[model samples]
Target: MKVLVTGGAGYIGSHAVQRLLRDGHDVAVLDNLGRGHREAVEALRASSGKEIPLLEADLQDRAVIAARLRELGTEAIMNFAALAYVGESVTDPLRYYENNTAGVVSLLQAMQDAGVKRFVHSSTCATYGEPEVMPIREDTPQSPINPYGWSKLFVERVLADHAAAEPGFAYAALRYFNVAGSDPDAVIGEDHHPETHLIPVLLNTALGKRESATIFGLDYPTPDGTCIRDYIHVSDLIDAHVAVMNELDPDREDRRQMIFNLGTGKGLSVKQIIDAVKEVTGVDFPVEHGDRRPGDPPSLYADPRKIREQLGWSASITDATTMVRDAWKWFQENPSGYASQA
Candidate 1:
């Protein structure tokens, strides 16, 4: 399959690029490099020994992207390009809509122009927005509390509508929970500017990159008085994407517009993640408990049975310790992330 991976320079997307190349698929990357690292893509090239093309352009650049898609003969698209900061989305709603929501519309338009039918959208569990249930399902009500969630949910809607109108179009929107860890080889790993994810933040503190890691809202109604979230390894998450991409046959009625929640069907509290980092890295960093952030649910995890039963795909690396170990391996080697390669 000739695949075009959007945001293929970022953490998850870069991992996808590596997996695709290893799976013997012809791959090209499309990233604006605004939030993604060119170094990550370069590392992928070095590791895979493939001169993978990296198209440095925005998703909203419809004409240029369409031309590139046609030139590359792209058969499918795996979109991971978006501004994903929840707090930042709250502060700047328009930017979220413009980039996260409007960007997909433009990409779909390009897909249409290029005659590409298959799409694997990178959705999120934030779209659920504090569901009353313990394990969220694909049919669960989507009531997003933030612009980031709404931005992604809106794209899902667009994909659904587009698929409905075009019978031959196929798409799979994988609503992911907390995606952590890195590639097992440590060739690439999670690196975000102004890092916010719990695992990376805790690992950074353990490495003495920061004074301490703060736990927001430790008075939640969980066993540890902190928010519990399902942490899926980056490699496992990309495996699900590859499975969906391979199964996206528009001729099959059930496979036209697929939606699945990706996770390990288990939840880990923030305190548990902190402990895992300390244990894995052998550093007990200072921990401060702060007031709970608004809109934070007590627990959010996926049922994951749908993907398991249908696609025979379930998370292999489910434990927080193993995730921390893989992540620690990368952090220990590259304390400065991809920038260390320079």
Candidate 2:
């Protein structure tokens, strides 16, 4: 399979590109370098020793994308492009909608034009905002409280609509929870500007990037009085994407739109994650308690049974200790992320 991976220069996208290549598929990366670093993609190409062509173009240009898809003979598109910050979405709803939602529209149009029907979308568990039940399922109510979630939900809705109308169109929306850790080999890792993720933040604190890690809302109803989230390893998340591509048979008569939640089916609280980080790095970094941010649920994890039963996919490296240790290895290798090399 020849696939084009949007946002392939970003953390997760870069990892997915490596996974796809390892699965014996050709991949081309398309990224605008707005929120992604080109160095990650270059590092991947260097590490893998493969000529992964990268198209530095924005998704908004439908005509160019359509032409490029045709030129590259792309059989599928794996979209990981979008503004993903929840708090930033709350502050700038239009930006989220335009980039996350509207960007999908542009990509879908290009796919339709190029006769590329197979798509693997990067959705999020945030779409199931404030769920009443634990271990969220595929049928869980999607009531996003933030624009980031809404943006991804809108893309999912549009993909469903397209699939229903066009029999040739088939898509898999992988709704993922908190993705942590890095490539086990430390080839590529998470590096977001003004990073908001908990694991990386704690690791950075251990590296003395900041004075200490801030514990947000230490009064939640969880066991540790903090929010609990399912942290999926980056490697496992990429494996799920590969599983989706392998399972998607557009030629099948009973082909249907696919939706699955990707996670470890285990929730880890903020305090527990901090403890894991301390254990992995052997450092007790300073911590400061702060009020909880708005729209944050007390706990969020996934059932993950559907994907396991259907695709034979499950988190193989998502344990808390392994996640922290792998992430620590990446941080040690690239203390300042790709910027140090730049």
Q: Rate the local accuracy (lDDT) of all candidates.
A: 0.94, 0.90
Model 2 TM-score on a 0 to 1 scale: 0.98
- TM-score per candidate, in order? 0.98, 0.98
lDDT, model 1: 0.94
Task: Give candidate 2 regions above 4 Å deviation.
Answer: none
Model 2 per-residue lDDT tens digits across residues 97-174: 998999899999999999998999999998988999998999999999888989999999899888888889889999
For each predicted model, how many residue pairs clash, with residues at least 3 apart or on different chains?
Answer: 1, 0
Candidate 2, 207: how far from true, in Å? Answer: 0.6
Off by over 4 Å in 1: none
Give candidate 2's root-mean-square deviation (CA, Å): 1.1
Residue 160 of model 2: what lDDT?
A: 84
